[model samples]
Target: MQINVSTRHGHLSSESRARIVRKVEKLERYFERLTSIEVTVDLEHEESPTVDLRVSAEHKHDFVATGRASTLAASLDVAIGKLEQQLRKYKEKVQNRHRTSGRGAGEVPSLAEREAPDVDAEDEEI
Candidate 1:
């Protein structure tokens, strides 16, 4: 997956950028076909150091996650956690739908067997 890191309203350090790359790289273990990710880090100039982590990935559909924390690491953790939940839910839903769509061999109706009509009740019409 290609990860693009951007910082707004603050000077991003080399370590901070590397941290984001490392964290996003780990997502491949869960979803290998990830297309891209965008991470935005903002440091509060007024009070505490607040960071926001946002991630976007491509699969059967687009998945997005966002979270804020006092630290960049914590924020990234929450974002990844949310993404994991989404991927799991997507997988389960697809599996459930596929399972429900299948019909067993017993459910098949042969043309002759289905067209044979009721011999015993043919005399008594409904």
Candidate 2:
């Protein structure tokens, strides 16, 4: 998957950028169909940095999450957690939809078996 890490109103050191890339790459484990990941860090406020993550997957709209914390790393972690929860829930829903056809494998009752007991009562009266 393609990963782009961009900063706003500030810059990150090579080491810090590398760390962010590494962490973001791990998101693929949650959903293999991920096509791209975009990480936007807004450093406009020095005290509290904001991180926005946008993840795109096959046949789905982008999954977006935002996090703000005292440190950039902390903010990124929070955003990752939110994205993980979203990906997990979506994956479960997709799997469930494809896993079953809304019917069990057991044998279905015949038309006679489904009829009401009035049929048996009429026969008994005859």
Candidate 3:
């Protein structure tokens, strides 16, 4: 997956960028088709650091998560956790779609098929 890390209103050290890459790479285990990941770190305020994470996958909707904390690593961790939850939900939905696509081995009768006909037996006058 392609990873792009950028800092807004501040400078990020090389070590910090590497750490972010390592953490983001772990997401691939949840979703293999991930095409690209974008991480934006905003350090305008020294006390609070904000991290914006966006992940794109093949033939699927993109996932985005935002987190704010006292440190950059903490914020990244929070955002990553949110993204992991989204990926798991997406995986479950896709799996269920395939599982429900067709009928099972046994055929179940519908309500109309289960009901008896309403024909009257004593209709000799007709």
Candidate 4:
């Protein structure tokens, strides 16, 4: 997946940038088909930093999470946790949908079998 990191009103240290990249890369374990991830860090105050994460996946809506904390890493951790929850929830929903959509194998009769019953009906009185 492609990850783009940007900072607003502050500069990101190389070490911090590397840490963010590593943490974001771990998200692939949750969703294999993720297409891209955008990370935006905004320093609105000297002590509090806000982190925004947007993750795009194939055949699914984007997942977004935002966090504010005293440290950039803390904010990022909170946002990543939120994203993981969303991914888990979405995966459950999709699995449940597919599971509930069809009858169990061998429970449904073929079209020709159903028609055979109708053909025998003409030999008896309704």
Candidate 5:
């Protein structure tokens, strides 16, 4: 996965940048098809540090998590935690949708069945 860490008002040290990479590597265990990881730390004048994370994967679903904290590392921790929850929820939703849509579809008679009319049902209705 590609990880880009950019600080808006302040510069991040090499150690901090490495920590960010390590923080994101945990996601690999959850989602193996990650395409890119973008982390932007915005330091506004007199405002708390805000970390915005945008993680993209091959599935075309984007997982975003934003957090503001007194410290950059704190903000990053919150953002990553939120992303973990999002990824799990996203996986569950996709799995459920596929399961429901692909299964139990052929069990019921469709509208076309009534339109064409089976001989027994047609005669009974008539």
Candidate 6:
């Protein structure tokens, strides 16, 4: 998967960018079909930075999360956590969609196998 890290209102050092990329790459473990990841850091407010994480997966809408914290690392962590939960939930849904509805083979008889009661015989006996 491709990871693109971009910043807004500020610049990040090479070491910081590398660290962010490393941490973001771990998200692929949660969803193997991920196509790309985009990380955006907004430093408009020096004291509190906001991190926006967007993950793209095969045959799925983009998963997005935003986190604001005192530091860039903390914000990124928060965003990653949110994205992890989203990916997990989506993966579970996709897996479950293919499963049969908890019904075992021959547990219930088909309509054609059911016999109609003898109404005329019951009336004669009454």
**lDDT values for all models:** 0.71, 0.93, 0.92, 0.90, 0.86, 0.92
Task: Flag the better candidate by lDDT, 1 or 5.
Answer: 5
- Candidate 5's TM-score reads 0.75
Q: Candidate 3: where are CA atoms >4 Å away?
A: 104-126
Q: Flag regions of model 1 displaced more than 4 Å.
A: 45-60, 104-126
Model 2 C-alpha lDDT per residue in residues 74-107, reported as the tens digit of each score: 9999999999999999999999888666776556
Cα lDDT for residue 82, candidate 1 = 85
Candidate 6 least-lDDT 10 residues: 96-105
User: How much does each candidate deviate from the true structure in C-alpha RMSD?
Assistant: 6.4, 5.0, 6.2, 6.1, 6.4, 5.9
User: Which has the greatest lDDT?
Assistant: 2
Kindly indicate the candidate among 1 and 4 with the higher lDDT.
4
TM-score, each model? 0.66, 0.81, 0.81, 0.79, 0.75, 0.79
Query: Model 1, 1-126: lDDT tens per residue?
Result: 567888777877899789878877887676555677777666754243444444455544677777676677777788878877877777678777887687865687789999898887977774
- Compose the digit string of candidate 5's lDDT tens values, residues 24-75: 8888777777899999988874257899999999968799999888888888
Q: Cα deviation of 37 in candidate 4 (Å)?
A: 0.2
Candidate 2 local Cα displacement, residue 86, angstroms: 0.3
**What's the lDDT for candidate 2?**
0.93
- Per-residue lDDT, model 3, residue 122, is 43
In candidate 3, what are the lDDT values of residues 46-79, reduced to their tens digit?
Answer: 7989999999999867999999999888999999
What lDDT score goes with residue 111 in model 3? Answer: 79
The runs of at least 3 residues in candidate 5 whose Cα sits more than 4 Å from the true structure, single-residue gaps closed, are: 45-47, 105-126
Looking at candidate 1, the ten consecutive residues that score lowest on lDDT are: 46-55
